[model samples]
Target: MESVALNPATLSGPVWVVAPHPDDEALGCGALLAALVAQGTEVWALLLTDGGFSHPGSRTYPRVRLAALRLEEWRRGLQVLGISPERSAALGLPDGALAAVPPEQVTAAVRRAFQLAPPALVLLPWQRDPHPDHRAAWEPVRAAWNTPVLGYSVWLTGRGAAADWPVAAEAQVLTFDVTPHRRTKAAAIAAHRSQLGLIQDDPSGFTLSAEMVDRALTGPELYFRPYGQSVD
Candidate 1:
């Protein structure tokens, strides 16, 4: 499968990166985001969920407290990527249950977020990224902004089924080498402490495995551009 190497400089300004949870952006598109910011692209982040569901079983951090902490972590990570807090918006939707939300409602929130600085390009989770929230996020974002989008992979590499990957006819494959911004990407990923095992009370709470983190930090992030869309 031949893929074009992504050059951040070619992208237009006011690019928006949408994440279903706090850490999805860092895990999926951190390197590319760093690259875009370094090249002086105007970047905005939109978080779809409260991110409190990860530590559901933790007594030390209740849902509200966990959500607040995760929001802070998200902003901190964005800061590392050169995005100011003023450029980010969190929808506060339910984590792990995006599919349950009304489609119009979700669409409305996403549209609202994009109004301030309409996106020239959008980076969103792959439609078949293997996480329910990731998959559910696809439509509303598309509905909100009918512009060029690069679908970044989060769980696709690790947990996706064979059919989940984009076929030749479905998308134009693109890859961005993370080598130059590896350190920046890693720092952004590291800012999410709760996802990195900071919450010890929830026995079944979500924590990014070392393997997942390593895979994310590895070079060449995958992006799928749907057919008929031009990123430029």
Candidate 2:
């Protein structure tokens, strides 16, 4: 039962999640986030991208309007999972353009998220995810490694996406098994209707490309402390 943090404090106060995109939240830690909210955690989700590249027909739609639509998708999705709009932020960064962003801008965003969140446990994508968004999303919250940084995998499955970050940092990896609550998790994911058109068009196309999605989450959750405090 060491899979999830059983302490009520496990979900207490101001929790922040840095997602590569809107669906990452639901796919990565939907159950945990829901469980935390069910226990009363003030959760904030900082979505890094607008998911602009997802629609093959996006070229026909105004980028700004498309961005706005995706933001709404996230809004509805979070609501289904119990997260308020005030608790969520959509940066709307250009999709597939993260690696091209200026370093200053990336650092500034990360610095701001922490300043605003002051999170007890900052959640982010497991560094090894295949999606570039997942990799680039690291820009903003990476420095918070000094605090408790929990890496959630939406790509790698069997046991969650494995963390590729060096073990020289003070980071923790926790896995939440949502099999019992898969319906809630899946419903939360379905809230992103605009973004899931491929699956919407064909539900059978739901592939776990993120790598973290295939790793079955276990009970009590799994936590890995990366740096082990030696770095500090």
Cα lDDT of model 1 by residue, 1-232, tens digit = 6799888888897999999999899989899999888888899999999999998999999999999999999999999999999999999999999999998999999999999999999999999999999999999889998789999999999998889999889998889998888999999999999999899999899999999999998857999999998988
Candidate 2 lDDT at 66 equals: 58
Residue pairs that clash (backbone atoms under 3 angstroms), model 1: none
- For residue 211, give model 1's deviation from the true position in Å: 0.6
Assess the local accuracy of residue 57 in candidate 1 as a C-alpha lDDT between 0 and 100: 90
Where does candidate 2 stray beyond 4 Å? 1-12, 58-62, 144-146, 158-173, 198-225, 229-232
Q: Which of the numbered candidates is closest to the native, going by highest TM-score?
A: 1
Positional deviation of residue 46's Cα in model 2 after best superposition, in angstroms: 0.6
TM-scores of all candidate predictions against the true structure: 0.98, 0.75
* Total backbone collisions, model 1: 0
Q: lDDT for each of the candidates?
A: 0.93, 0.63
